[model samples]
Target: MSGPTGILLLDKPQGPTSHDLVGRTRRTLATRKVGHAGTLDPMATGLMILGVGSSTRLLTYLVGLDKEYTATIRLGQSTTTDDAEGEVVTEHDASGVTDAAIAAEVATLTGEIAQVPSTFSAIKVDGRRAYDRARAGEVVELKPRTVTVSAFEVIASRSSGTLLDLDVRVAVSSGTYVRALARDLGAALGVAGHLTALRRTRIGPFDISDAADPEGDLATALIPPAEIAGGLFPTATMDAEAALALAQGKRIPVAVTDAPTVAAIGPDGRLIGLISVRDGVSRVLTNFPNSEEPA
Candidate 1:
């Protein structure tokens, strides 16, 4: 509860669960109030947004941001988990799967579409994780949900024997699973398919290129609350009295339009909270304690 409060853009290495990085961040920063906006599988590596201290309140806003990933989809073999980490469940000769046909199918997968998440995913069923039930040998049935795939472009292709591997870059909305895309792509092309590699490149305004390795200096890597909020939402500068009124849970008069939420900055240029405007009146949606003060 008492430490540097801000966001930490971490480049998570493969083989560690997202939770593992969170734990490591806690140890490095010496704070237990760390939380992440999204998660990646142990076999995946990518940018992970971590909120430290009071910045944990910001995670809720960051979770729904669109994400981008670069991955390899291996055609000719399907796996139980829809990724290379799972056992092979089916195999096919993908050599006959033409590039034009793959491109056509990829086009169909773009835009808004209904998709079923992989059974070995983190989705919860009956208060238990779907993956847990799947590993226990129980059938896990997940419903299809609408998810937008803004872009699904094949960067390169490699063929070996009867297998074809496609390197792809995908931009998708939050909650869209890349593994499922690979699985569905293969199924649509009449061949078995699964993700062989995945690395998230971007999430909203945050990019992997700006992310820091968790093993390095985490304290210095903390991004202040004001900077984090400014990057995500339009900002409204408030005077001392207005900042106090909003902090006291009272509505303040501020003109905001177009955006559903705006970051409220206090007279000192520190983020005070988030506010939403309705008919020119701003109401507090979230309030942050003055980061300069002790917890």
Candidate 2:
């Protein structure tokens, strides 16, 4: 049945990469129009929003939203990848690490700070992935970037030999890396560290409960296009004249009440186009479905 299209929230499993999940969803839905909002590491299991059909247009708004994750950081050994999948390069006594120390480090990590992503990250360097360079024994020195760690709380801690396992929950802005947080936190305390577990709990307004099972029907899990458009801003119904003009990508003199982004709906409540307030005039950022049929 043809209808309004949008994104599906899936609770991605641990074994498959984000791209693998997209491939599986495409095969299941029998459509090549599927794409993901963001990439999740293979070791991470949690909410992944998959865009389908014309709904892929929504990613520009969705991907920039903040995300929340729960993770376990192991302080004692440094890893090549800064995660459990990497080989341990060094180990030391972590018994000296106290919960209070970890708390202080968390405080330091919170708020706006500079972060260096793991070398085994998807960040591109010289037209090659950082991880590829790292695996090839190449030293990848990446510049630190600004990322806001809104919250960084240590929930639990345990000590085993030289290992100090810390469970933490963090809410951060887009591009913030928990793996990097673990690495930096350990170094801040003069101990090497690596991430052992990670699970994303939320992405903006979307949460784990809103996600479907990894093997569930992703096509059916998609939120109705109207709901997707509705989440951005107050809706504005377009007349036949405005609709036709928008379908042609032509600018109109109509005023948008929203401050930043505004969704324009047609007479039937069908999402036609996305318009933004530029200075004072409403300019088109993008149009979903067909510019002719809906936009």
Candidate 3:
């Protein structure tokens, strides 16, 4: 809590679990108070949002943001993990699968649909992870959840003897799994499918192009919490008295309607906290500890 506080957009390399990235970030920034907004499989590379120091409080707001990914879906073999890392369970001659058919199935997968996650996912079940249960040779039956897939476009395609590979870009809501989409698409086409590669390109407004390499200069890569809040929510300027009242757990007479939460900026231009307006009054939803500290 005493170190630099800000958000870090990290472009994670493959082969490291999301938790591993956090550990490396903690070491790179020399702060143990690092946290991430979302998780990525060890086999997948992409943009990972990390919050350092007091900015860890901002991760909850970022968790629900939409995500964008570019991936390769193999259309011939289905795997235990719904990815290349998993053992192959089934194979088929995908050479006969037509591009028109692939397009049609992809169209169906787009928009809102119910999808079952892969058995090797990190979803918790009865106080244990589904992947943990799966690794123990137990059958994991995850319930289907509704998720939105705004876009699922096949950017390129390659067909080899008995297999077909598709390079695609997908934009989806939070909690939507790209592996599930690959599995469902393969199943719909009569050939089992699994993700061969995946790279997250964006999360909400944050792009992978702006992300920093965790092994590089991470201390200077931190984005101030105030700047992050300004980009994420509606802004409202609060006078000294109002800022003090909110800090003291008192509701202030600030009316806001543009958003459910407003980024409250103090008179000195420092971020006070996030506040919610209701019935013509605003109350602090989250208060920063050192609001008066100079940026």
Best candidate, lDDT: 1
Clashing pairs in 1: none
**Cα lDDT of model 3 by residue, 96-200, tens digit:** 999899999999999999999888988999999999999999989999999999999999999889999999999999999999999999999999999999999
Look at candidate 1 and tell me the lDDT of residue 165: 96
- Per-residue CA lDDT of model 1 for 1-295, tens digit only, reads 3477888999999999999999999988778889999999999999999998888999999999999999999999999999999999999999999989999999999999999999999999999999999999999999999999999999999999999999999999999999999999999999979999999999999999999988998888888888989988999999999999998989868866735899999899888999888888888899998844222
Where does candidate 1 stray beyond 4 Å?
A: 291-295
Ranking of all candidate structures by their TM-score, best first: 1, 3, 2
CA RMSD per model (angstroms): 1.7, 2.5, 1.6
TM-score of 2: 0.93
**Deviation of model 1 at 238, angstroms:** 1.4
**Global Cα lDDT for candidate 2:** 0.84
Q: What 10-residue stretch in candidate 2 is worst by lDDT?
A: 286-295
Q: After superposition, how far is residue 57 of candidate 3 from its true place, in Å?
A: 0.7
Q: After superposition, how far is residue 221 of candidate 1 from its true place, in Å?
A: 0.8
Q: Model 2, range 165-195, lDDT digits (tens) per residue?
A: 9999999999999999999998888888999
Give the Å error, residue 107, model 2: 1.1
